[model samples]
Target: MCSFKKVSPITSTGSLLCTSWKQITSTEVPAVSVIANNSSCFQRLYAVLEALSGVEPGEDVLRLAHKVQALPNVSFKGIQCYNGWNQHIRKVTDRQAAIDLVVEKTRKALQILKDNAVECNYITGGGTGSYVFMDVDYSNNLDESGALVTDFSQSLYVLSTVQSVVPGNRAILNTGLKGISLDSGVPKIFGHRDLTFSNGGDEHGIVRPSGNLKVGDQVWLIPGHCDPTVNMHNWIVGVGDQVWLIPGHCDPTVNMHNWIVGVRGGIVECLWPITGRGPGV
Candidate 1:
């Protein structure tokens, strides 16, 4: 049974209304509880749950959900918790532990809902980065050439040319933190695996070359975090042929672009406009 209503407003203010609704829903129970003692604004049929630990969410969220569901005139729909902090662990075992923790917490909440006789039909695990598998096994699958085996994470590349080389095996590049995200970590130099990249500032990057690298030589950087990095740019230039860019974080990156362009043989093929652009306040 689908207990959650997929509501959509056909107006520009739809998103704003939805955001406001979430806030209102979260706080309405407390306000109603206070009012129920004196006035008939609402009936305090369910108990108001106290706050639990800051890191782990508990019955308090479900308490609010129960209250919302009890509203006479309002349509009742289940909640969707949008938390995915634990899903970003690099190690597979660590990632599994994180997911298990989330599931454990979810199980507690579901029990609370069951006790309250509240129907929760839908629940979401996470958005993008949480579910993305960084390491993929493509051992059996191979191209017809038989020499090429596909790896998942080898997609996006920040191609830049070497600007200058200084003493102590250091080389300066034309891109830095402003061009790509360093939140997850610094990007590694593609091809020159021995070379390490460090932040020089917003507009510059320092590359410590393990081998000889001359000026004007090509250098490709694999981004540490792909979301904010791609958001910092407007257009993606494709070089030789068709390329599929897989983002480290897909949700935020998708919001950064206004248009998606398709190019073939160095010629513009098609363009599609993106509806949403997330702005930082």
Candidate 2:
């Protein structure tokens, strides 16, 4: 694996004057090199230049690309051309227009690189907001049929137990602000369409119109946002005879736990320690 420390120079107009890239790894990991099957010591860097080029002058983009290409131990893989606004576009025409703009900008950037003799081999961009079921934020995105897209299944749920009940009106759950995140929106009850979830406090969740639910009944909640919610939990219970819990977000969520418990047929299969946990990891 290779890491680059970013150092940016800003212009008077708040545009990027240039970006400096420095490779911190002196020796390459043999495992990574073998997996890649590449003998070159140079690491590939995919620069997110679309946003910069869109905001900065064209000359600045060219200059930045040239500087990255000039780095000795780095290979400028290519540029990532994307618009974040496209992810939430509900109309097909509007989404197409956004994609067209991204294509135009990407072509312009590629032309500039080719003219300057900068070698660019690949281009990558776009996001999975339209393809995956992650949160309430993605629930509004429309497909070609003008209906909501449901390309992926939602497999993540927060298993919480009811601690208190108020008859037909409401029920209090064990999960609250600390158990789940509310930045995107309130979590939805997995099977109970009539029930709504709200933050009760640090240690409780409010379920309105609780219906037939009573104390000790388990509630499966679909998190509004999965990233921070996964960061709040230590264990991800897997499915089998035992309850299964999968992380909504993998990278940062794994950093919060000490071990990954793998199970098979309701039995403990293996244990992997998370060596890269805590700050700066």
Candidate 3:
């Protein structure tokens, strides 16, 4: 509850896109459109965090002075690193030493995230540089590694199966990503036994060398990438405690929808107003 130049924050898309404001009475501060709706808020946020890194608030005063008396035995979390206002990563001068520091810091940040597991989507704030240099800590969980996103391509498989699944043959599989899939995102095969779905040119899936297929068996084909795969489908479906319909691309797809949808217990529900049937918002 200390007074700085002024702002409180809020975000709906992500904490990344969030903004804060100080209390403003109508008589004291006029509501300004520019500050409320744009990127200026981001710059302001950087300034505040940067300043806080150097200045101890009231609660830290005793701890601060005690450390001052001890002369250099302490480090503060609120201290700034490098440039005050950037979301980019920097190369470390000494790799091993920097790695040591990062491991120490991330171990704690991870604890904070686990504690807030029920309250946040992500506890994110090291820039791109931080992501590469800073993420390393754990007790007993296998890391899934970073996620790789790609566009839809006519060639290649997100998941590939041996067209030759001969029983006595060696196990042939090329894995790009390994983990659980929410829906497992299997591409749809319109109507052929040999599912021939390409990047976007050929309609039916390319039938590889005969992998003996019995009637009604499923082959989960991964798209060359996600974006075009999303476009190829009538809709890209997400299922979870948190299911959602995200646009693959907003502008082109906005006019194409006749209705909007929501889900509850595996059922799709239309939630748009009746007037939504008419175009042009």
Instruction: Pick the lDDT winner.
Output: 2
Estimate the TM-score of every prediction: 0.54, 0.56, 0.20
Worst ten in a row by lDDT for model 1: 234-243
Candidate 2 residue lDDT tens string, 77-176? 5566666678667777898898888888888878887888877777778877533226555565688889887676443345566666654456677766
Instruction: Judge candidate 3 at residue 167 and give its lDDT.
Output: 33
Worst-scoring 10-residue span by lDDT in model 2: 235-244
Q: Which candidate, 2 or 3, has the higher TM-score?
A: 2
Question: Where does candidate 1 stray beyond 4 Å?
Answer: 1-56, 70-76, 81-83, 126-151, 210-275
**lDDT, candidates in the order shown:** 0.47, 0.51, 0.28
Sorted by TM-score, highest first, which candidate order results? 2, 1, 3
**Which regions of candidate 3 deviate over 4 angstroms?**
1-196, 201-260, 264-267, 272-281
TM-score of candidate 1 versus the correct structure, residues matched by position: 0.54
- Note the residue pairs that clash in candidate 1: none
Of the pair 1 and 2, which is ahead by lDDT? 2
User: How do all the candidates rank in terms of lDDT, highest first?
Assistant: 2, 1, 3
Model 2 earns a TM-score of 0.56
